[model samples]
Target: MLNLVDSRSVIKIIPYELIMDTVNEHSCHRPKPTVVTISDLLATTNNDDLRFALLYDPPSVVLHQCGGSGCCQSKSETCTHSEHEELFLEIAYLSDPDYVKKTYLLAWNHTACKCAAKNNNRVL
Candidate 1:
């Protein structure tokens, strides 16, 4: 069970079903599942929804974990589209067998890359 705290102690029992009603436990990695829906992926990155993901945290905090690429390996630096996608795909690949069958990994990867590239192409 998760608990929201006033000062580092678990004060209130936050239900395990979700970090909140809007966010599902599976999406938040409660059991650390993979193969999230596109909407789930978007929520994790957006500045607003991400803040409430944890039981305790402020909107100003943005979290990034290490990605294997050595170009600019610091987790502190904001992640690029490729890096984020790679991490997402990796988890889904390892943890969700259905993900490969449903999305057809290679095709999905290609499509996602194209979409990301198109988004990057936006200049205004």
Candidate 2:
């Protein structure tokens, strides 16, 4: 323990209360989370916007093999969407934002989808 004594020289001091009171409400806001669940996607529907988004900003081919829903998919297999659908899925990303696309890319089979592949392409 140290005892306080009057200093010979007067120095400027900032009040602790003043410093603490200056807290901004936004700064105190809850931090954003890093991980998320497909339940967020469950709120959406039969992939209209998802398709539009993919049509707008195509993602890298690196994530092409991703199982979209991140579900029971094999090493190089994807779930049912039709090649056009899959391409749209690969391109469409179930019609959501890139973050949604990323979520879709890494998500599991959120829904019970049929398993198949179609070698078809479409004009987007």
Candidate 3:
């Protein structure tokens, strides 16, 4: 009888403060995610083959197929954006100087894992 009463009492005193804090945390505004435009990607590289491939070829031909060793090694099975300052600066000139998007060859997609064929391509 005493155990049941204590259990009931414990259940009745719900932690309202924790609930409110969680609600507030979820409600707080988050900044928008950065994305690069096709034009921006095109303008960054001087390689004629890459420029032509991006402009003329379909995405299927431009990117490598999924299920590679790299895919298996990655945490999300997707290659995340790398923070390379030199690469960032190279691509930064194509976009707004004040708000430059981070440079990345790999695109983040759960179902699909198609990225540039080689390191030299440098397509985002």
Q: State the C-alpha lDDT per candidate.
A: 0.28, 0.33, 0.34
What does candidate 3's lDDT look like per residue over 1-124, in tens digits? 1122463463344477866666555331221234444454466567554444423212221222222313322234333222222232222222333443333342322233332334433323
Better of 2 and 3 by TM-score: 3
lDDT of 3 at 41: 47
Distance from true position, residue 99, model 3, in Å? 35
TM-score of 3: 0.20
Per-residue lDDT of model 2, residues 53-81, tens digit only: 53322334321122233332333443433
Give the per-residue Cα lDDT of candidate 1 at 103: 19
Task: Please report, as a residue range, the 10-residue window in candidate 3 with the lowest summed lDDT.
Answer: 56-65
**Candidates sorted on TM-score, descending:** 3, 2, 1
Q: Flag the better candidate by lDDT, 2 or 3.
A: 3
Selected candidate, larger TM-score, 1 vs 3: 3
- On a 0 to 1 TM-score scale, where does candidate 2 land against the true structure? 0.18
Listing every candidate in turn, what is its Cα RMSD in Å to the true structure after a full C-alpha superposition?
Answer: 18.3, 19.2, 16.0
Mind giving the per-residue lDDT tens digits that candidate 1 earns over 1-124?
A: 6557676566766575545543332121111112324334435343443222332211122223222112222324321223232222322222232332211211022111111222233210
Runs in model 1 deviating more than 4 A are: 1-10, 24-124
Mark the regions of model 3 whose C-alpha exceeds 4 Å error after superposition: 1-31, 54-124
Q: TM-score for each prediction?
A: 0.15, 0.18, 0.20
